[model samples]
Target chain A: MSSSSSSSSSTELSIPLHVKYIQSLGENKDDLIYHMTSHLRLNAIYWGLTALCVMNRQDALDREEMIAFVMSCWDEEAGGFGAHSGHDAHIHATLSAIQILILQDASDKIDVPRVVNCEPSKHIFHSRRTLPEMLTEGLPLLVILSLQQPSGVFAGDAFGEIDTRFSYIAVQSLSLLGQLDKLNVDKTVSYVLKCRNFDGGFGAVVGAESHAAMVFVCVALLAILDKLDEIDQETLAWWLAERQLPNGGLNGRPQKLEDVCYSFWVLSAMSILGKLTWIDADKLIQFILSAQDPENGGIADRPGDQPDVFHTLFGVAGLSLLGYPGLETIDPAYCLPESVTKRLGLRKNWKALPKRT
Target chain B: MPRVTSNNSDDEAQLYCEKSEWQDITPIPQYDGINPIAPIFYTPEYKDATEYFRAIVKADEVSERVLQLTYDIISMNPAHYSAWQYRYRTLVALKHPLDVELELMDAFAIKFLKTYQVWHHRRLLLTALRSSAPSPLSIASKELAFIIRALSTDTKNYHTWSYRQWLLAFFDDEELWEGELPYVERLLETDVRNNSAWHHRYFVVWGRVRAEGEIDVGDVLKREIAYTKDQIALAPNNPSAWNYLRGILEHTKTPFNSLRTFVELYSTQTAPGEEDIVDLDNPKPGPGAQLPCAPALEFLADIHEEMGGEQTKKAIEIWKSLGNEYDTMRKKYWEFRVKEALSV
Candidate 1:
C-alpha cells in the first residue's frame, strides 16, 4: 500500500474511540432510534461485532452477551432467526445470526444434520420442494432452501420478494452451515447471471440497474459456489474500478454520491475477482480515514455525516481489505475475519492487498 | 428505515394501550426481564402497539381492528415485515378493497421511499388486484403513474426503479412496454447522467430485440448509438452514457472501431468553438463538457488496440495518459490494463 499522500497527516483510524462507540451502542436503552431500528437489530449486531473484530478488538464487546443476543433473535417457529425478539424470521437476519455465531466461535450452537435428509414431497411444489426430515437440526438450512423460487432467486421471506441479495445470503448461510450441497448451485448461478447488466455489474433483480452492493453479493456468492468462471471478470473489474471518484471514495452506482459503504461493496467484489490491485489504495485509505469521527469514533457515509454502524462496519471492512495497519484481515467473499473463515475451511479464492506495516 | 416523526397532534395523542377496545389484550414485551441481551428500550407508545400486535398474532385475529393496529405499528416502524405480512393477510381475510389499501400506500410509499417493506406491500396489493380486477391494464397504468411521482422525489431510489421494472415484466402487456421507452427518454432528458434511466432504456430497447412486430435490430442499433453519442456530448464525463454506448456495441458484437471517429471527438482536451461546423455523424462535446473524458479516452484506446500491429502503440499511450493524468483515481487499473495487454 502506498503511503505517499497528504491524507497521512490529519487522518488516523482512531480505533480506540471507534471501539468505545460500538461498545456504547447497546447501553442506551431509552433512545427512540433504538426502538425504531428493531427491524435491523440482528444485522446491526453483526456489523458492530464484525467491525470490532476487524479492528482486532473482538473481546471489546462481551462475547457471552453477544452470543446470547444472537440466540435470542432465533425464531423457532419459522426455523430461522429474526431481526429482533418477537419479530418473524427472515433470511437476511438468519444470515447475520450465523455470521455472528461463527465470529464468536459459537458455530457449534447451531446443530447440523449428519447428512442431507430432505425428502421430496409428493405434493406439487412451485419450485423443487424438499421436505425436512428433522426440523430440530439444520432448521435455518431448511428455511433458506425453502425460500428459493423456481427462478433460482431466493425470497427475503414468505412474502416472496426475490433479489440477488437473498440469493447471496442463502448461499453464504448454507455454506457456513456446511449444507451447501443442498442448494441448487446451477439454478442459483443462472439467476445471478440474469441479474448482470451490460456494464458487467450485478443488480438487486433482473432488469434492474447495477449497484455496487449487489455486485459484491453476487460476486461473493459466485465465489462461494466455485462458479467464478461464469462472470465477465475483466469487464466487471473495470466497472468496479471506475466506481472510485476523484475524491477517492467509491459510490454504489454511476453519478451517485461517494459513500463509505461502497468502499467495501466495490472493494470486496474486486478483491474476490483478484483485482484488488486495480484500485488506488493510498487515496482510498485517505477517503475512508477522512470519514472517521475522530472524537466519538465510528465511520459515516461521508465526511461530516453522522456515523452509523452500517457504514462503520463497511468502512473498517474496506480498510482491512486495503491492508490498513494493525487490523485483522477480512475474508472478501464472506465479510468475516480471515482467521474465522480459514478455521472453518470455507475460505474461497480471493486476494486482499498486502497488510501495510 | 429511520423513524418518520409525525407533527400531527392527533398521532401524538392516540395510544392504543390506553383505549377501552384494546383492554382485553395483554401486551407481550420483546424481551422478558430474565437477562435480556442488548434489549431495545422501545417507547411506551411503540411498546403498547407491538404488545397488542403480539396478542393479535397469538389470537390469530384477522379483523378490522387488527388492520388499525398493524397500521399504527407500521407508521412507527415502516420496516416491520411481520406487521406488513399480517396487515396483508388481514386485508385479504377481511375482503377489504385492495384499491383503497393501495390508495393508503401511495403517500406512505413516498414518505418511506427506501423502505423495502413499503414497496413489497405495494407489490402484493398489485398482484392481488391484477388477478381479481376487471381491467388489469388500468391498474397497471395507475401504478406506473404513481411510480413516476415516487421517482420525482428521489430519482435514483433502487426500490422504486426495481419495482417499476417488476411491474412491467409482471404485466407482460404490449401497451406497458410501448410507453416504457418514452418514459425512460424523459427521465434521461431531465438528467442525462441518470444510470437508472439509461438501464431502463436498455431494458426497453434491447429487451424487445426479437419480439413480434418490433423494429429491426439493425435499425435499433443505429438509433441507440446515435442517441448515446448525443447524450455523451451533453456530459463528456458521464460514465453511464459511455457504458451504454459500449453495451450496445458489445451486445451486438459490433467492433469498437465502428465508432472510432466519434470516440476521437472527445479523446482530446480541446472544447469545440462556437462557430465550429457540426457533423451529424460525429457529435462534438458542448462548451460545458469536461474534455479529456476518461471513458472517451479508454474507448479510443480500445478502438486502437482492436486494430492491432502499430495501432497498439497508440492504445498504450492513451492508457498511460489515463493512468498518469486524466483518471488518477484509477491509475493502478490503467497500469494493470497496459501490463495485461503487453503480457498477452
Candidate 2:
C-alpha cells in the first residue's frame, strides 16, 4: 500500500485508484468497519457504482454480485429496500436500490407486480415467497405516498420524521416508477415553496436555515414536478453561486466549512437553474481533484481527510457535471448517469457543463 | 439463527465466524497501487464495537443486552443511525418508559448536538408520548424549553431548530404561539445576527396567519417591520434582519417605494452619466457611515425595477454600485441585475 499524499499539483482524477478503492471496500468481510457500516451498505454500493460509472469504469465492480447484494437489502415487511439486510425499510435505501438497479440495467429483475401487491395476509400462509419477492413489494410507491404528512412534507418512514430530503426522495422514486400521477403535486410543491427562505435557498424543513443540500433536493423536486417557476430563480441562483469559496469548494450554508459533497449539491442546483456558468468550474474541478486520496481510491470531504464512498461518488459526480474529460455526463436533477436517466425518459431540463475533449 | 454470545472477549470469534461464512464469495481485486488502510480503521476499539454490533444484529435480540450494546455504540458515534434504530426498537419492545428514554437522550443531545439521529430519536420519543401523555401541551412546552436550551448552546443548530419547529406543530395553544415571538426576541437580543432566531421569528409571525385563521396581519406586519428595522439599525450588515425585513414587507405587499422613510434614510446615489459605466475596480460607496448598506441598495433596486423609465435607470445605477462596492463578491450577479434593469 502507498502512503497518503497531500500534493495539490496532481489535478488529474485518479480513476484507477478510486476504482480499486471501491473494489477493496467489499474485499474484507472480516473488517469491523464493514460490519459497522452495514446499515449504509446498499447506499455505499450505489455510491461506489455511480462513481465508477462517472469514471467510465462501470464494470469494475461485479454487476451480478452487486445486484444480489442490493436485492438482499429488501425489508420484506415494508415493501422497500433497507440500508442493510436486517435494517427496516426507508425511502432513502429504497431509492438507492432502484437507482442501482437502473444503473446496472437490471431493473427488470425487480418483481414490481409481486412486490407491489404482496400483502401480509398473502405471505402468512404461503411462506413460499422468495426473499426478494417478500421485500420488493409494489408497496414502496404506496408507502412513500402514505408518508406524506398533512403539511405536504414527507416522512422518511412511518416514524413521521418530515424533511425536504424525504420529499425529493419520494418524488424521484415515484417518478422513476411512473407514479407521479399518484402524488399530491400541488401539496408537495406548496410545502417545498414554504421551505424557501428569503435568501432563495431551501432548508430541510420549514423555518430551518437554508442549506445547499436541501436546496438541491427542493429544486430537483420542483423540476420533477415542473414547478420551478414557483421559486425566485435569480435570487436562489445567487445564493447557490455564493456557496463557492475562494478555495473553489462549496459549503452547505453560510459560515460553514467547504466540503467536497457540496460540489454535487451546489452544482446540481446551479445546473438546474441554468446558472452553471456562475461557478468557477476550473477551480472547483481542481478542488474536487485535490480531495482525492492519492494513495487510496476514494475522495474525502476535504484534503487530508480519510476517503469514503459518499464523497467519492459526489466528487466524481460533480466532476462529471463540470464536464470533466472522459467521464460520463450526470443528470444534475437525479444524480444518475445522463444516459441512464435519458433512456428511462425521466430526464429534466437541467444542463451539465459541456464535456471537455 | 446464530446463538448470540454476550462476551465482549469473543469479538474475534464473531469476526471469524462471519468471515468464514463469506469465504466462498469471490474476493475483489486489491489494486497494489492503493494506500494502506487509514489508521482510524485499525483500532482495536473500533473492531470491538463493530463486532458487538454484528453479534447483536445476528442474534436479532431485543433484550437489555442489545440495548446496552446499542447505547455503547451510540456513545462513541452518535451519527450511527442504525445503532439508534436498534436502540429505539429495543426500547419499544422492552416497553422502556418514554421519559427514561428522553433522559438518556439528553446526554447524547448535548454531546452530539448536530447529529441528526439524536434529534430524530428525541422527536420519536416525544411523538410516542403525545398520544398517551395526560398533558400533551405541557410535554410539548417542556420539549420547547429543552430545545431552547439546545439552541442557546449552539444558536444555529439546524437539527435543534427543526426539532423545535416539529414540536411546536403539536400545540394550538394561543399562549404557546404568544410565547414564540418573545422567545425569538430573547434569542436575537443575545445575538442579533442569529439567522435561525430570525427564521423562527418568521415562522411565528407568518405561521400564525395559517394556524390561528384569524390574525390581524396588518398589525403583525407593522410590528415585525419595526422589529426588523431595529435589528437592522443594530447591525446593518446582518443578512438575517434584512431577510426578515424583506419577508415582512413582501407578505404585507408593502412596496419598497412606499417605505418613504426607509428610502430617505438609506438611499445611495451615483454621479450623473457615471451610472452607465461598468467600473470593475475601486467602485465608490454612498457617502456616510450609515446609508446604502448592501441590502438597502438591493431592496431599493428591486423597487425601482418594479417601477419603470426613470426609476429603472436609477435601479441600474444602484445595481452597478452594489455589484462593485457593497456586495463585490456577487459583482457578477449585481451586473446581471443591472443588465436586467436596463433591459426592462
Candidate 3:
C-alpha cells in the first residue's frame, strides 16, 4: 500500500479501501470536523453513497441508517430536506435528499403529498387529491418556478442569492419530480444562454468567467431542457478539452491548478458532448489514482492534499465516466448510476467511454 | 470506557467518550497526544468548538456572550457557515449597528478573503445598512475601494468580484456606473491577463448600453475592439484579451471580415511572415513564432471560411499550423475546426 509501490504499478482503483473509507466517514460523531461539517452532512452523504455506488459497493454503508438520516434532515416548515436536521431547508439539500432516496429505491418513503402541500396556497387551490394528481395540477411546479428571477436565473431559496448552479438544481429537481413541462423552459434556457462567455463556456452567472463546474451545470441544464442545439457546441467542447493539463488533471479555468473534482466536471461535459476522447484518458486515470490516499482509503483534491468525501465521489464518478473496469456506469447528465436513471426513464442522449476489459 | 493512567499514577485520564459512540470509528494510533483514545481520530479543538456551539444552540440566547462565542468559532473555522448564520441572528437580535457589523466583516475579509461566508455576511450587513446609512452611495464607494484593494491582491477571486458587482447593482446609482469603467481600466492596466477585470468592463459597458437607449452600440463596440487589440498587442497569448475581442464582435454582430482585416494587419506588424503553405501533419516553425499571435490566426481561419472557396482552403492550412504548432494541446479541436471548415 506504499505510495511508491502503488505508483509503480498500473494504478488501479482500490475499491475495497475506498469503500471502507466512505463507511468510516460517519463513525466519529464526536469528532469536531464531523460536527463542524453538519451543514454539509446530507450532501456529504450523497457524495459518499454515490461514490460507493459507482464503485459497485452500494451496500458498504447501512442503507436503513442512511435513509433514516436523510429523513431526519427533512425540514417540516419548508416541506423539503435541509443540509442537517434543524437547518433551514435549501434547494441544494432538497435535491441531495431526493437523489439519495431515488438511488436507494426508497422514493416511496417520501410523503409526496405532504411535500407538495407544504405550501398550501399553490396546491390546495388545484383540487387535486393524490400525489400523481397534484403533480398533474402543476402545484409543485409553481413552488420551484417561484424561485426563478426575472433574469432567468434561480436563487437557491427565498433569500435571493442567485447562481447558475441553482438553475441546474431547479431543472434537475423539477425533472426528477416530473414537472419539467411546467417550467418556463424558454426563459430558463435564455438565462443559461446569457451565462455563456466568449470562450463558448458557461459561467456561474451572467458576465462571469467560464468555469468547468459551471459548464457542467449549464450543459446538463441545457441537455435536460432539450436546448443543447442552442449552444455553440464546438467552441464549448474546445474550451472543455483545453481544461486537461500536462499532468492529465483538469482545472476549472485557464491559469488554474489542476484538481480532481474537475475530472468529473470536465469529463461529464465531454461525455454529454460525445467528445470524451478529446482528453488523454490514460494520463487522467493515472493522475486520479495518484490523488488517492493509499493508506487512508479516500481521494484528495490533488496528490498530497487531505482526502474529503467531495473529491472521493468526484474521482470515482470521473472514473465511471472514463469507463473504468468494474465500476457502475454513471449517467453524466444526472451524476446518478446509469441503471437508476434508466429505471426512472431520465437517461439522456449522452455517451460514456466504453468499458475497459 | 477505557481509562489511561498517567505515569505519576496519582491521576487517571477519563476516556474521551464512551466507546459505543465511536464503535466503528478507527482511532489513529500513531500520535501520542491529549485524549489518546480519540487521538488522530478527532482533534480536541474541534470537540471543544462543537461543544461550545451546541451549548449556544441549546441556550437559544442572543447576547454579547453569544456573539463572542460565535466569533471564536468563526475565527477557528471561517467556512463554518452555520457559525456566521448564528452570528448574524445574534447581531440582529441584539440590535447591533449595521456599520459596526460591516466594519467587523471588513476585518474578517482581510483574514479570510476567499471564504464565501465572510463575503456573504458582508452582503447581508450592507443590505441592512442600505436605508439607514447617511449616504448609501458614499458607503458603496467606500466598499468599492475596499473590494478594489482585495482584487489587487488576488485578481481572479470570483467571490470578491461577484460581491463588487452585487454592491454596484445594489447602489444602482448612475454616478457609480460612470466610475466603474475607469476602475476596471486601472485594473487592466496593471495586469492585462485579469479576466475578472475584462468581465467587469463588459458588465459595466453593457449596463450603460442598456441604460442609455440612444447610446450608439456600434461606436461602443468599435472602441472596445480597439481596447482589446491594444491589450492583445501587450500579450498576444492572453486568453482574456482574445475572448474580450470575440465578446465584442459577438455582441455587436460585426462581420468576421472586419476582425480578419484587423488581425491580419496586427499580426504582420507583430510577427511578419510570408503566406507560405504550412504542413498540416508536421509541427512546422519554432515555438517563438507559433504562439505570438494565436487569436489572430484563429480569427483568420474563421474569416477565410466565411469568405468561402479558395479562402476556405487557405483557412484549413492556417488552422493546421495553429492546431499543430501553436496550440498543440488543442490539436483535436483545431482538427475538428478544419473538418467543419471543409464541410462548409
Of the candidates shown, which would achieve the greatest DockQ relative to the real structure?
Answer: 1
Docking class of 3: incorrect
lDDT of each residue in A192-219, candidate 2, tens digit only: 9988876678999876778899999999
Stretch of 10 with least lDDT, candidate 2 chain B: B30-39
lDDT to native, each model? 0.85, 0.76, 0.76
The digit string of per-residue lDDT tens for model 1 on B202-307 reads 8878854355655677888999998898888888888899999999999989999999888888988787677878899788988777787888999999998899
For model 2, the DockQ equals 0.16
DockQ of all predictions against the true structure, Cα-based: 0.50, 0.16, 0.12
Candidate 1, residues A204-227, lDDT tens digits: the string is 999899999999999999999999
lDDT value, candidate 1, whole model: 0.85
Clashing pairs in 2: A17-A297, A18-A297, A115-A136, A115-A137, A115-A138, A116-A137, A116-A138
Per-residue lDDT tens digits for candidate 3, residues B231-275, read 665666677777777777777777778865457744442444446
Using all chains and alpha carbons, the TM-scores for the candidates as numbered come to: 0.92, 0.78, 0.80
RMSD of each: 5.8, 8.6, 9.3
- What lDDT score is found at residue A195 in candidate 3? 84
